[model samples]
Target: MIWEVFRQEKEGEYHTHCGNVHAPDREMAKQFAAIQHGRRKPTNNMWVVPKEEVGEVDGEKYSFGGTTDKSYRWATGYNVTADDASEVVESSDEQEDAERRRSEVV
Candidate 1:
């Protein structure tokens, strides 16, 4: 059986697929994944999932976020006064930048 290994380099970060390991069971898969990929990198966490359990969806099968414009979801769509909090302002700025980038992409 084959097991896919996902490694997370830091805390609260995303786990990316590093590689796969062939093992008879889940326990052996974890051991193999740790030795093969986790030893060299700064691994915060690891996930060993069976290949058959994973599911995927392609662009042809479904449309993500739909075809219509969803400007209401953006922070800029709402009218609001400037806040005194730095975090709020930073988040708004990030949202604005994301909206701008998305517009450019489309």
Candidate 2:
């Protein structure tokens, strides 16, 4: 059977399960997974289990929370501070003009 493997990079980030591989046994599963999931340079780790082992929750059937006057209760989700609005100003006018001159010379 074919089993899917997934790896999570950081907190609040979704796990990206790359692909599926079929194997007749656990040793074969690991071998196939090592090639499929481990061959990449950035492969951190993976969850290798049988196809029948994993449980799934469907999107429609999954309940986030009950519907009610949720604004005050779930206010944390909507809160954003002014510091979040700050943008990264990487380059300035002088740097841009210098780069333009170098590009023109090239």
Candidate 3:
């Protein structure tokens, strides 16, 4: 059986998929994943999941945030005057920058 390995380099960090291993069971899979994926990196944690148990969601087939208009949730959408508040102005600027970058990619 094939097992997918996810490695975390540090505590409080997200586990990202590193590679795969071939093993008959979960325990052996974990061992194989450690030897194959963990040794090359500064691994803080590892997760071995059976390949058959894994699932995927294609972005082309599904809308992850649903088909609702969520512009109201964005900092750019609010018509507030951030005259004296530096943090709010900074957040709005960041949001606008991100929106511009995403639009360029699309």
Candidate 4:
């Protein structure tokens, strides 16, 4: 099974996908993932998804970077001359409904 580790960054914030873990079942995998990824800090919640249950499709090329030479791929790429935050412009309105996030570290 495929499982994902979601970490709560702060109070009143939804858990974010820190990483994924794979195992036979959701419960066991979550147990493992929690210790490996979340036990170091105070995690509000954890979700373990069977690898088979987690569905993701990588685009033919790169769905995230519409074109080549992506400025979006760099660490400080967003510290650009543009007035708009690249993430805000690219993210759909639906994503905004999920939760707002801020962190000193991921």
On lDDT, the leading prediction is: 1
After the best TM-score superposition of candidate 3, give how far the Cα of residue 45 lies from its true spot, in angstroms: 0.4
Arranged by TM-score with the best first, the candidates are 1, 3, 2, 4
Clashes of each: 0, 0, 0, 4
lDDT of 4 at 27: 74
Per TM-score, the best of the predicted structures is: 1
Better of 2 and 4 by TM-score: 2
Worst 10 residues of 1 by lDDT: 77-86
**What is the alpha-carbon lDDT of model 1 when measured against the actual structure?**
0.94
- Candidate 4 segments exceeding 4 Å error: 55-106
Candidate lDDT values, in order: 0.94, 0.72, 0.92, 0.70
Candidate 3, residues 16-91, lDDT tens digits: the string is 9998999999999999998999999899999999998899999989878778889998978777765757887899
Q: Which model, 1 or 2, shows the larger TM-score? A: 1
Residue-level lDDT of model 1, residues 1-106, one tens digit each, is 9999999999999999999999999999999999999999899999999999988999888878878978899988777765646688899899999999999999
Tens digits of per-residue lDDT for model 2, 5-24: 67555555676877778998
Superposed Cα deviation of residue 94, candidate 2 (Å): 6.5
Looking at model 1, residue 62 earns an lDDT score of: 88
What range of 10 consecutive residues in model 3 has the weakest lDDT sum?
Answer: 77-86
Question: Lowest summed-lDDT stretch of 10 residues in model 2?
Answer: 82-91
Question: Model 4 scores what on Cα lDDT?
Answer: 0.70
